[model samples]
Target: MALRSVKFMTRPFQHNSNRSIEIFLGTMNEGNYLNVGLGGSTQTIHPDDAKRLRDELIKLYPLALAPAAAPASKFKAGDKVTYKAIVGYGARGMDGRKGVIKDVLANEWYMVNFTGGPFDNLIKVHSDYLAAQPVEPRGFKVGDKVRRTTGQSKGVVMTVVETHPTQARGDIRVDGMTGWRMQKYFELVTDDPVEAVKAAIPTVNSGRYLVVALEGANYVPGSKPKVHVTDIGANAEAERLAKEVGGTFHVFKATFEASREKPVIPPVKTTKL
Candidate 1:
């Protein structure tokens, strides 16, 4: 009797998205006449069986196809945004995840604090994966009691010290709180309020510097009088100390002459008495 052999070929489906695809192949024997053993190498698959395998494989092609979605944007350090996962790539209940803006990284991505967890586990999402959430003000006045939304001692407003744009350092009192008795610190609040204050603050000139003026001394001619410095901080410490101890402290300007510069020479007498 002659033996029949067959070969099967399969191709994977391709999609427009940047994702991986896989293909699988299988064979079966129909004729029991040829006592086919597992190691005999005479495995045969009927033509109908091959067509059924191709159809089953095609059913899985849709699973490999990813939906068309936008790419993530380049996020910055302080941008408030939200996100939603692309279908077939995210959890069933986590279609739309909301979180506070925290950090941004290279490859056009940023982080959002969805579960209030450590930075490492925070969602590192692409720009197109997130949407900006509308920030609603917490109904607390400048002096109203409000705690830090996030940080070491979260939710303990202690006191509402001040609110400013970009940064808001609140003086929080944590004397009675458990595990936070000694944690007296400030909260750095960011967002629109702080940003507004920052914008309103005047810009200071960087080139200008502060200078201390020297004290001037009073002196009388001929008499050895104690000199007093009217202005104190302007001169050196030793000069100030000397003036305090009855020594004259003189103010020297480029064009000004010192009172002690000229010594008194008595007039010479030529006539004999």
Candidate 2:
């Protein structure tokens, strides 16, 4: 028999945006082998019951997006949701579309009633394909420094509002734009003034003698003000750092030897007491 193939619609092969499975018929030799394409790879199977196999794959189309061990539903009835990048069937171009979760199902699946713009019906979608409506981030608080994971966009969190019980999303002011952003889009940025100041100072060696380092009168205070010590050859780096920071440092000469010195009391001469 000549090789005959029938291409089926694309389905999610894995929980990734760039990966999918394209089901189709493959070469039918004497043994009748069919090929299933999965994430840029192919698997050959001899199906005694082709109809049954196709039915099983159809049922598993959405579940394949979630792990084998499904997680508990993070959403509940009446929760607002939006489609994630990986959508099923005709869900393409449905970004930013709003939907209401009617019911949460077993195996990380959800029954959502989508509204408006190619979404006038209910869809049984997987949890991986749905995202809760934007709310304040659960971990972020007011006055947190955040920067975008992708580009140079960064801002301080100004407002955080709770819209759902599962998680919170926050608003940030980045590049003169203020709006609620996804928590996963940004990361926290931290800085330690003390560590920064220490890094600015040069490394120096304490000569065989006593070495003392004095901070500049104009030294910028760190989170904690304290002395720092390091080894510098010939005090070269120390001198440069002192000059740059308008500070002064000195190296004293001393002798190292074993001594058993004892404190002596002075004799006091007393008159008539």
| lDDT score, candidate 1 | 0.48
Ten-residue region with minimum lDDT total, candidate 2? 156-165
Model 2, 145-261: lDDT tens digits are 555544445333323332223443444433334555666776655578886466456545553543355566543434542233434542554576577865666644443768887
| Candidate 1 global TM-score | 0.22
**Model 2: per-residue Cα lDDT at residue 99:** 94
Candidate 2 residues lying further than 4 Å off, grouped into runs, are 1-71, 87-90, 136-273
Q: Write the per-residue lDDT of candidate 1 for residues 25-117, one digit (tens) a residue.
A: 333343332222232344345666556655997887745767777556456567766667786775445445567658867677666667533
* Every candidate's lDDT: 0.48, 0.63
